[model samples]
Target chain A: MKAAVIVFPGSNCDRDLAVALEKSSGKAPIMLWHRETEVPQDLDLIAVPGGFSYGDYLRSGAMAAHSPVMREVKRMAEKGVRVLGVCNGFQILTEAGLLPGALMRNRDLKFICRDVHLKVENTDTAFTGPYTKGQVVRFPVAHHDGNFFADDELLKRIEGNGQVAFRYAAADGTVSDATNINGSRNNIAGIVNEKGTVLGMMPHPERLIEPKLGGADGKPMFDALVEALS
Target chain B: MKAKVHVTLKNGVLDPQGKAIQHALGSLGFSGVDDVRQGKYIELDLAETDAAKAREAVERMCKELLANTVIENYAISIEG
Candidate 1:
């Protein structure tokens, strides 16, 4: 499976996502710079990783969303290329209109950095097929702006379409407002486009892929994509 | 030419920052302050001197890059 990790100036997770992708697909992903105008046409997946891209100026992901590279990213997404956006990448995707909703600052207004359990809400997607429905997996989530918000109409539409891929939940997999880690609307932690090709989320699944890293729950997510694309 | 732009979260969207500011004011004994909503104010110095064209340019910038229209509403004012 061919994959790439898009790197913005302040993106610190590009190499980490590349590590996980290489370990899963057995091929090192090209680190595509943010200023470049095109993605390699043969790529099956493009990952926008986490970081304070553009120093979070104006807003997180706002500036990076308009970078020259994003125009190509949007074009490729239209062609059905799978895209995974994590944390700040998720913000960019929303700011770019590739995904729905907005990620606002955490309700408490403090940066939260910790491991949280996420329940796989949709097992039918390419990113979640390896997990059973409602299965709870712990992933590291670190961000100040992770609260997801959407208009009522759009929220109902996406929820009805089963576009929600994951939701923050308790350790036992119970989804409740109290269990929401970042105050995301409907406890949403991740979602896919209507076509199910683009996935964006605030949690860092790549951080949990190795046994020595304290969990292997994240490996299957990458494996599922590689298997589907290969 | 100068342009001032205001970007604010749409109504019905939760403003946690604003809420915090409201609470902080309450703690300071400032009552009757119904609420506080925080927004962004940006000033741009433009080369376009025509008032109408400068306003148009800023409006385009607001739509394209300055504001996230899905969640934000932007207003522009050109100054002499």
Candidate 2:
């Protein structure tokens, strides 16, 4: 798959995401700077990596969402290109109106950095096709403003449309408040847009694509994109 | 022209930081504090001179950047 990783100032995970994409697709993805207004038309995926973009000045990802490159990213997504945003990337997507809901301050007001379990809620979408529905996977979440918030009406709509892709869960795949690591509404860890072309999640999947990094649970997500897009 | 903007979390949204502050105040022996809601106060110096036009411009700024309308509400006041 022809993919590109968008790099903004303070984006620490840009290289890590590029490496993961390269390993899965067998080709190094193009690195696009945040100032660029255009992206290669042949690209199939655009990955927005994690970290405090724009120094998290006003709000996490708020400034980066308005970066020039995002206009092209939005245009590309409209033409059916897949977009995957992880961690701070997720915050940017939501701020950019590419996804629903807002990521707020953690309920406990602490920066949580640890491996947590997630339950795959959908397997039919390109982002999660390689994993079975209800499968449990472990991924590391590192963030302070990862609490997801949505009003009742919007939450019900996304839930009814199956936009939810993954939820915080236990080892046996049970989802509950106790398993919710960030106080995300409905334990949401990831969600897709209405067309399922855009995905934004708070976990750092690229951080654990290989066993040497601790686990390979995140590999299937990349592999799924390669298999489906190719 | 000077524009003062106050961005506050919308009602019905949980304010964890405000709650933390409230708790801290309670522990410090302060009483009768029903609630504590945290918000951002931003002061901007604008080149626009007319108060009406300044208010209008600052409103746009608040809508576009100063406040996220999804979870926050903003109020703008202009002073010369």
* Number of the predicted model whose lDDT against the real structure is largest: 2
Q: What is the TM-score of chain A, computed separately for every candidate?
A: 0.98, 0.99
Error of 1 at A125 (Å): 1.7
Candidate 1 residues A77-188, lDDT tens each?
9999999999999999999889999899997888999999999988887888999998999999999999998889999988999999999999999999999977898999
Which residue pairs of candidate 1 clash?
none
lDDT of 2 by residue, B1-80 (tens): 89999999999999999999999999999998899999999999999999999998998888878898889999988999
Best by DockQ: 1
lDDT of 1 by residue, B1-80 (tens): 99999999889878899999999999999999997889999999999989999998899999988988878999898998
Candidate 1 Cα misplacement greater than 4 A, ranges = none
Q: Each candidate: what lDDT?
A: 0.92, 0.93
Candidate 2 chain A least-lDDT 10 residues? A122-131
DockQ of 1: 0.83
- Off by more than 4 A, model 2: none
TM-score of each: 0.97, 0.98
